[model samples]
Target: MSLIPKSHPRAKSLLIREKLVLGFEQGLVAREGLLAHGRGEAFDYLLGEKTNKAAKQAIKAAAAQILLAKLPIISINGNIAALCPKEIINLAKISGAKVEVNLFYANEKRKKNIIKILKKNGANEILGINPNFSTTLSGLDSARRIVDKNGIFAADVVIVPLEDGDRTMALRKAGKIVITFDLNPLSRTSQTANITIIDNVIRAVELLSITCKKLSKNNKNTLEKIVKNFNNKKNLSDNIIEIRNNLTRRSRFA
Candidate 1:
């Protein structure tokens, strides 16, 4: 295995177990997997990996919106695998949502691996498209997306953490309410989502879990208000411009 870069800051939570398990699926690939993982890590770092005021508010609002769903699915990606597995499962459970593995690289092999990893990390009730016992998602099954028949059509709301653009677009076209966490804020995935959290996955999941636990029937209207105010394209454009201008202003020092 290639050595960790010298410039990398050691993450307190990503222990040897996390690294060993995650290193392969992420490190094993070139453009397809690891690249996305690394970029997400950067976004996580930028957001300080903590639930700030804005994030908590978003989380509460998101929870209220999510609770309104008849068939809510919590979609996980590779970056999610590398960051917060239990948190994702826990949040979904608390919110009365279903946990399903979804990735850009759709396959049984990767899907199974994701399941195995999540289960090892205290995850139960992991859902899949193919309920067949033998099919592995990351390794065994080609595309283990058993949640929806076609692109989240059956879903009223889909909580997609660290999503891919293609799937997000397809879900939108299917008219599903798509909520996601995105660091870049300018990517198509962010632009197309119903609610976009401009923060790190670790922090985003933490807040989401907290919000769901504190949520109740009484707070439904509050959540509706927050969600009602959310517009993906507007939020994406605003954050993207802010990030770009920040980068440009800093370029003078370089």
Candidate 2:
């Protein structure tokens, strides 16, 4: 990682870029993943590079959904493995969600690298590796359709950060509650997910973990109320409005 000073205005963003770059070099992130991160970064700029109120609402709802789920699974890809492996593990631990490596650019070596990192970061059991347990999810042609029978296939809720659109739709079609962290509120992944946190994955994961811990003490009825009260469409619309407000505010300075 690069030694970026905290005083730098773009330090955090620069550090994230460095992590992805290093991940690409270390075979933990694909070149395509770098491109995806760049795209998300552009939206982050529109979002003022910070978590907004809409995102916080989504996070709270997502935590409630995860807690209410009988079987929750957190899906991991190479970019996620490289960027926030410890956060992933912590979220899984707090939410009692199973950790699984499910990548769009699926490959054995990359899977091994991701699993190794997760294990190194205190992950005990990760699913979505063995071919014997692999099952194809209906309605998707991407490599992401292949999921472990015990993992995503059977999960009641799935937390898929940095996810693809088709898989998000497919997971929804499969009757699983899907949560995602996407910088772009307008993306299909954001629209398709049951709860979309329009915040950077690194920050969103930690927030979700913390929210899960805080919500864990609540009764099932309370948790269900939180989930039921949330409306994804309304939240996404609010995020769009927020972006417009941000742009308008910045235009004054310009």
Candidate 3:
């Protein structure tokens, strides 16, 4: 009955569930975090991962906006690589968006390792400097964290999946369009984002691919139409209300 010990047979299962939930708030993901644990248990019980209808709609809008972009880029972090590397690469190829490796580790060696993993998986054209170099974000994913008026700043739109908070907030302040994935509807990363998908990373990525394929023949006006209709704040607020109402109803029933 002791919950404090990892030696318990169910400890690993419980730990994974907890981490998956925690990953949303902390922006630091570890195997033992709550988000990891929750996702594992969700899959175990929900028959292994799925995306809902609302999420698919969001993905369609995302795909259209991305396809219409002249130069779209995806910011890849360690968590994304671990969960959905292949899907990320496929999406990049389809959307014609470049991939950039970004992480929270502010160390040079860590940067090299992360880039190596990305390159081996077929990513080309890495940008390490933003022309406004500072010692602040140096260890925050290696290769120098510089935010100039160029680099990431030059991008019209950026898709940053499984991202960190500080950089995301900073990016928005600098006037960049940011789209991100955060499962928890209440998390800052989700709320702060221009477009947020409240679904598991794997499910979101796969659905994103499907939407991209559908939008392949779409013209600019059509793509813009999709973008014009997707209300990021509205979707997020709706999702939060739905989740909360369901929880309240379940409590009453119990």
Worst 10 residues of 3 by lDDT: 130-139
Ranking by lDDT: 2, 1, 3
> For model 3, what is the alpha-carbon lDDT of residue 36?
42
The number of the candidate with the highest TM-score is 2
Q: What's the lDDT for all of these models?
A: 0.65, 0.93, 0.65
Q: lDDT per residue, candidate 2, 15-125, as tens digits?
A: 999999988887899999999999999999999888889999999999999999999999999999889999899999999999889988878898888888899999999
For model 1, the local distance difference test gives: 0.65
The window of 10 residues in a row where model 1 has the poorest summed lDDT is 133-142
All candidates: TM-score: 0.75, 0.98, 0.73
Instruction: Estimate the Cα RMSD of every predicted model relative to the unseen true structure.
Output: 5.4, 0.8, 6.9
At residue 204, give the lDDT of candidate 3.
Answer: 81
Q: Candidate 3: what lDDT?
A: 0.65
| Model 2 stretches with alpha carbons more than 4 Å out | none
Name the top lDDT candidate: 2
